[model samples]
Target: MRVEDAPEAWEVVSSTERFKGRVFDVVTDGVRMPGDEVADRDYVRHVGAVAVVALDADDRVLMIRQYRHPVRRLLWELPAGLRDVEGEPLAETAARELAEEAGHRAATWHTLVDLLTSPGMTDERIRVFLARDLTPIPEEENGFVPRHEEIGMPVEWVPLPDAVEHALMGMIHNAPAVAGILAAYAASVEGFTGLRPADAPEA
Candidate 1:
């Protein structure tokens, strides 16, 4: 039997907004099940996001540490941001995030992986990109100013193998970061021949 995730959606009998937040909204959906039962499902509605697995000339993956209030732990993560800009390309979002958060720009980019983060609880999807041939953006040219949780965020470079180990050892808890790290390593092994174009449509 062929194993693949095919797109399918059960009938939504009704949907109501439970709460609205700046970044995402909570909605309760009454969905019709196979047994003709209507089940109420509460899930978060998100605008999606993009992340970058930036690899430097020395094969080091750029990382950032920020305090996530809900988890209450300063976790290491890739440079990522929301797809909040209307009609903006996903790759552009990833590049913007890399420049703003990590102060670097990539000469080459490719789609690494796409994730349905917590599909059971949210429709938050993220696309991770593989970036290489990086050049630092001059301090004066970087116009983005960090604020709130972004302020004082520290950026670091870790070898790809070490990043994979950290992800497997449960040191890196960010879902996108873990997924990007493993996917990048796997692609690296094959000389990144399996990667798609940065502008490839999401699967």
Candidate 2:
């Protein structure tokens, strides 16, 4: 629970409006040292979020291509969202986001793991989930079908082989999405990794 000898060495600095009018705050804290000494430290205080790494019956990973305004780049990542309300449980957020963002429901859903997106100064954690037996129920106000170039958020079925390949090749390069993929792979060893395009024994 503690970090660098100071488990609770953080406090919210200033709350501000996040994207879509969401509110977030910056946290300032200190690192507790030996003999209970404290040194100043600060981080981006975030409520954290949940991300789902879903797989269809065909063993394909569901992904979304998003054009991040901040980074000014298009990224392929697992469906993810911020924790909306105070009493909102992570699973609830995950399920809701999976539908709203990815437009799908999982017949089988399980929490794979939790990842600290940035442990240096921020407590930004993202819960990684493994979702299976998915059914598409597209959400309104999502995808390129809605606003096209204005919002480059679209879902695509990315095969596992290409997923890893592109990742290794620096194609699908989003931190949370990459973490979700690795976590999913660690959870289901019997499920992914083994065959490659070059290993097909010639077409």
Candidate 3:
């Protein structure tokens, strides 16, 4: 059936916060199914996030290799961060993350894609921005010193096609990285006219 015509199969009867953390909140929902069955579901509520696919003069994409403890590996990923700051514009968040994680700034920005990181589990949305006209920020010139995940993150500029190959070969597992690289590659094939304005509403 088409989603627009699909019935509302599950109605939330009640919801309570099960846990609250700095990054996200877990809520337990008591839901009523269409067949009169009731069940409890737990999922995470998040503040959303942004990722940057910063393409440079020679057509290389800025990338970072960072240690993800849960995954127990240093995974290659696009510069990204949570939209934890209340009321921060999404474009600003993308720009901030690009500089913070990759130590670069972009003069041109476009909305590459909007992603739901894991739709079945969390309400985490990520806006992936295509950044161009790149300029580097010296370590001493950056506003905040890198820490935690950003500290010593391995930064690199990989050719855009190489990044897409890495993703297709299962060498790049980060969701945003895979999607951003592929999407950016596709945009290039289309002459980049498909990209939306950075401030445009999520599609």
Candidate 4:
């Protein structure tokens, strides 16, 4: 289906800063009907951001355990975040998020894909990257709030195969993490045509 074909119009109604200091903007959008009638709709405009799947020399994936308030569940997933600030490019954002969320940095960066988290209602896009050539950097050096607020985050290295299995089995609930890990494996394996190494383009 063509996304542009969807009939919608948006106008900025107002914007406000929440208690957490996060800016929340309300948008008035119009939805077209079968008879060319339009119904105004309202939604929010959130700054987009990135996610990174960092791998170490042991072929183990770097992951963090954290709590998600929306689902009311703890999740095991790749390092990710929203643009803590506006006007940040996705590649740099991905690198920064990896360091902040996982307390790690990559010497090399490769963009795997750009994905739409929710295209129907929100303007959120997640650029997923594959990071290797890692060097452990301190969380303080990264200048990020640790993954958890009251408690500390446990960063674990899960073997890639096991991570993939867990993802398929629904144990790893982070969509970006699952997608990133599978894409990374495809790039490394000879038979995975859907993904090619970041250093090389698909044939």
Candidate 5:
């Protein structure tokens, strides 16, 4: 299942963590490359994450507006979360994030897209799921209090086509959100018969 364009081009000789953070770690790797070349590559090692492109029966996409301090902008994005829970399945991560962030659950789920957030900078992979047939869960029933950045986040339901237009028009800058909306729109154009299983292996 190797991608023809992504051949293994380097062999790692050693790896050392330069800095460890709550979310990710910076690592320096000594590698041997073709033509007897050796080099040190510094990059981020991430725990990965999942996002949900949740659509209701009316075909509106659920989105959240949250301020990203690093980027210094408020972004409208699909519900997403880090894969911090060890041994959690990817689909389960998506479902949990949907509930925790958007307070919704879906009866139908399918894998929409998998993305390597930044190939040269981080080994962070994200799985985006198409979630349909949604039911909202009240905060009293979920018993999960939104904190930190999640506090006071604004949630909205935008028409899917409008979302797709926003994503394509650069209004949605978050990588997973843009990709998820475009993927969902493309799937809809195909009558949604081409979506992969929720647990499909990453390509």
Candidate 6:
């Protein structure tokens, strides 16, 4: 048998929106189980997100430190953003985030990995892209103004090997960043021959 993740939908007897927030919504669903028992499952409804592992020609990955309030700590994370725009391509979202947050754009892009991001608790999904051929965006041409935790965020270029080590050492706590860094490292071992196109279909 092939090893794969197959999709199946249990019958949802009823669903109710429990709360609506700026970034995501909480919902409760009454689902019918295999034994005919109905149970209420609470999960977050998310709009999804995209992240970029921007690798420069020197093999350094673009990184930024931002204060994540919920965790009450500053975290090193990849350039990322919510999928808030309607009908925008995922690659475009990734590019926009990279330029706005990291002040760079990529000439080459590939799908490095797809993540569920705590599927048991939230329906949040993220696409991590491997971006290369980076060119810094001139300050005058970039108009994005950082606010809140993003304000005064420090951007750094860390060697890919160092990044992988940091993640393994529990220094990089951001989920997508850890996954992307590891995935990028694995792909690079094969000269990135098996990476999917930037516009690959979402899992």
Question: Using lDDT as the measure, which candidate wins?
Answer: 1
The residue-by-residue lDDT of candidate 3 on 71-144, one tens digit each, is 89999999999998898899999988888888889999999988888977897999999999999899888887
Q: What TM-scores do the predictions have?
A: 0.98, 0.74, 0.92, 0.76, 0.94, 0.98
RMSD of 3: 2.3
Query: Ranking under lDDT, best-scoring first?
Result: 1, 6, 5, 3, 4, 2
CA lDDT of each prediction against the hidden true structure: 0.97, 0.70, 0.90, 0.72, 0.92, 0.96
Lowest-scoring 10 consecutive residues by lDDT in candidate 5?
Answer: 2-11
Decoy 4 TM-score against native: 0.76
Q: By TM-score, how accurate is candidate 6?
A: 0.98
Can you write out model 2's per-residue Cα lDDT over 28-131, one digit (the tens) per residue?
Answer: 55556666666665567677888888988877899988888778998888888888768877777787778877778887777766677778867677777778
Give lDDT tens digits, candidate 1, residues 72-144: 9999999999999999999999999999999999999999999999999999999999999999999999999
User: In model 2, where is the ten-residue run with the lowest total lDDT?
Assistant: 194-203
What digit string (tens of lDDT, one per residue) describes model 6 on residues 1-203? 99977788999999999999989999999999988999999999999999999999899999999999889999999999999999999999999999999999999999999999998989999999999999999999999999888899999999999999999999999999999999999999999999999999975
Q: Compared with the true structure, what per-residue lDDT tens digits does model 5 show for residues 1-203?
A: 96554636578989999999989999999899778688899999999999999999888999999999999999999999999999888999999999989999999999999899998989999999999999999778787688999999899999999998998788999999999998999999887899999999875
Off by over 4 Å in 2: 1-23, 35-37, 138-152, 191-203
Model 1 — TM-score against the truth?
Answer: 0.98
Ordered list by TM-score, greatest first: 6, 1, 5, 3, 4, 2
Runs of candidate 5 exceeding 4 Å displacement:
1-9
Clashes of each: 0, 1, 0, 1, 0, 0
